[model samples]
Target: MATVGAGRDAGQNLCGCCDDVVGGLPTGSDLDLLREGLYGCFGGAFARELVVLSPGSIVLAGNHTDHQGGHAVACAVGSYARGIFRANGEGRIRVGGRGLPAIQLDSADLDARDGGLDDLSAMVRGMVALFLQRGLAPGDALGFDAYLALDEPVGSGLLGESALELAFAQGLNNLWAGGTLSGEELALAALRVARERLGGSSAPMWQLPVALGGIQHLSFADSGGAVAERIDFDFAQEGYNVCLVEVGDGRVTEPASCSSILQEMQAVAGALGAERLGDVREVDFMMDLPVIRDQFGDRAALRAIHFWREDRMVEHRVRALKAKDMHAFLELTRASGASTAMYLQGTPRVARSQAIMLGLAVADENLRHEGAACIHGGSPERAILAFVPDSVYELFSQGMNAIYGEGACRAYEVVDEGASAWWL
Candidate 1:
């Protein structure tokens, strides 16, 4: 296995360096595919290819609180999306990846987003919009040609869109802006891109880990500001491992079940005179619980309660991790999952995804006290995060994989160093 990065400033050819920097990647990351895919349109690799890498993130704790301007703890995982960029001097930005057809558009014309934030084309447009807003895009932009690749495991449910955008923007920053922006600054630009696309209301906290790859305890303020503190601790030293469990696929996003939870949470927030639960004091919310329930019904009140508690739990979870208090951290994550499921899970979007409940059940029943599990996020999450003692990792991963699907259970570490975390 090798690191298949696009050649940098040394006039590295995309096809020439395949054997050296491409094989170590995961699915959709084969450098040959990138070479063939690019060669199909262009003749060869451009001189001085600039390679960029960005990691996909997971919500380590604190679910459903981002939109409320609450706290969250996230980690950038080993899964990654990569970009090989070169200045084409063609006044056009062309972006394509393996299995993603090449789409060409004028760089100057990237003034509007063409699709959703998750859409590749639209994400590129969003990135450009942020770049332009920051006066980062050059006046006489030569544009760029980028061939992107990804290393995330299939069925892991990671959207590499943000990574691709970060890689694109980071490459442009280096080529045009003299690489002046810090990793966190680049991440903030990416977050702005997503917020612009999704609007200012939705929670996009996962952006922190993806753009600034590492373990971060993030506190987002009501004014739309953020504070990211690096949680420097080693799980390996504690003899534990964290894995993302993919329950099922094709689970539609924003199903009624998921929307209902948000709607209910918002309804309660409105009743309390705050736009988000995080803005309201916990004691104030608790005192008004009876009234909130009478107005929005019991479920709405329950959801609001979960929100305030989970928001506080997020901070505690970060403390537990920093202090190496695994047992405390493990329990908090589990309780958050329980609260999310009981008060906010709403219902399953599809018949198959009902397996979500079953998956949690299975984990709880089999893993016992030594391990802990939690649903990853709302929108009727199809994945769960499990922390298990490393001594039993082999049996645990194998057993879980047999129940879900082979390779559906992969272990990951807190990737703080090397190219995997280079985005930040």
Candidate 2:
């Protein structure tokens, strides 16, 4: 554990220039814990203090279509990653997290490749660089310090890296830009940062639910970027409990593991004379099925089949949510799962395991026809999402627990709010 405090105490390491304070505290319900961590690292003379937060989210629909310019439904989960911020006069921006050493950089000059580009430090540098490039920098004489933490984390938390990315970006906007940058702007900037560092994994709304908040229907159909519309519905009104059923700790991401699926889908799209399956006409695909099967092989054809059906299914599911028809939404979700199993998983890949399949079978015994279960976070699946009606939430939870063990199922509410900043 990283200790918080001042004056070179053993094991209570002070991150870059930290001194004159006493100790550190773990994250909890309030900003007090983050406040202490900030004071311990950068001193407490700063009057301007802000808290920025974004929740973890789940991809509700559009399984294999994120990169193909297709539409999807997503919602913010109950878990959140938050940051406490304050301005420091030294022109040195610093960021620290619970149980981790702080990373500091000069505000006047920023570098994307500096300091392990794959980690959170890169994100901090990217935020500073973005503000500076946009002519939105507060000033050369000012800098900021943020203490980041996860509150009530479930499994890996909903946002993962994007959660921290959104929090830090928004904090910078509020502290330095006079809160001028909108939530959409911050989300786009984070997407840009991720693209530069990691090659654009979840564009066009790189974790928009976290940055923008609420249950949303997102479309990547526009080439310019993502389009998100607020979805208004009371999930609890229907008495359905949305939960994530832990499958197992997913394996270390091999670059080729997840990409392989996208590549396979791409091959089929190419056979149809289009860049992505979304752009291909259904008639064109059906007419060219023989060519696709003969040229790209059966696996590619099958994945393309999954993509087309899923592309349409996502919009249908979104409509179900908009219509407030829980039965329709649940039915669509099950159909999506069946389609992925039959078409997308045509070839055996060790990294993409069947644990999720087994978990779904267990959920079926309890859900019967009233609830639904499917892979939670898309490929390299680690958790299964189960929608249980409130009347049977207990039975559903207990049944999942029996198979996956106790505490495997965690209830999550779709938070209506998105990312925002407040002074304390």
Candidate 3:
């Protein structure tokens, strides 16, 4: 329902000071990087109809808590997934992408796949299912030749899979549904796909940030639903730049190391007879600790402490962001990092990476720079996100990468726009 044009129009919403969201269009090099491997895959005909979607997400805080009905803060990032297609006129759908072979399915078989759906096929089948579930039949089938490019670091906590699913859903929905689905609807459909077929988690945390598009405070309600509130305050307004530093190369394969923590929290919640962990108070947890620990062990006690602290941290983080209190915000980041390390048991195999991250935070504070560093993602050792002043970024990046490796730090700005499409 939105439009993207080079010229300024009063009718179409513009991002910040420009007509383009996320600064501007992809740079020539950025476009070239995306197009590099797709030459032989799609000819000029298909390339001309490309529909580009918005970028992915980075969870700002409240990691590994969303699924258990806990809160989280997440935002859309600069990296994106794009697609190109035309009507195949064959009542069949085909999808092809990096490392995924091209697949074709008849429209009649949308509800029944021979062996169920993989990642790519899930997007098509999921969208079709969503349409059917809503009592709207997608008129025809169109095969897309698409490729996904992740601008974020490979092991970065950004949700590349969610980005791809959102892109595909947007493209297909636009084609079939006349783009009636809101960002939230698209995110819900993507969540269904992820849950039913792909066995992935973190839907609203990843999907809302990308779908709503921006630096947003995604508030998870007591009912386990979420609402995205656009954060109007810019980091540039406070002379700060957000950056993610790659501290390690390890990836957290699911049924991740964090599941134990989640299980422990859920068990604690059950023991308290509370519906959700967030509903269990600090007093309730502390008072019950002796009995809880006796029943669940020391790990459960420590995890309870983390759950309580993280709940408070998420609350305070929202306030800090709203107040534009960078100092308070950075302090909370350090506390979160410390809690994750000490109590939450977030070191996913490599303790050294976390140690270094904590060390950098100490150095950053000692230097009196207006910034803070913390373990970035759900996996404690993968990366660290720092809100550093633009002036100190080079010095900070150089020192961190000197130990971690070169090109380890990358900067990002929150942009306001979700999964959007423009006819190419």
Off by over 4 Å in 3: 1-39, 42-50, 98-101, 110-118, 137-147, 152-157, 222-224, 249-255, 349-369
The lDDT of each candidate is: 0.68, 0.70, 0.65
Give the Å shift of residue 236 in candidate 1.
1.8
Better of 2 and 3 by TM-score: 2
Cα lDDT tens digits for candidate 2, 64-119: 67777788777777676767887777888788777555788887667667433246
Clashing pairs in 3: 213-417
Candidate 1 Cα outliers beyond 4 Å, as residue runs: 1-37, 153-156, 198-201, 249-252, 255-258, 346-353, 378-380, 417-424
* Model 2: lDDT to the true structure: 0.70
Q: Over 4 Å off in model 2, which ranges? A: 1-29, 99-101, 114-118, 152-158, 249-255, 346-353, 378-380
Alpha-carbon RMSD of each model: 4.7, 7.8, 4.9
Please give, for residues 198-234, the per-residue lDDT of candidate 3 as tens digits: 6565536787777777776666654445776777668
How much RMSD separates candidate 1 from the native structure? 4.7
Give the alpha carbon lDDT tens digit for every residue of 157-194 in model 1.
44335556566667777766666676666666767776
Answer with 1 or 3, whichever has the higher TM-score.
Answer: 1
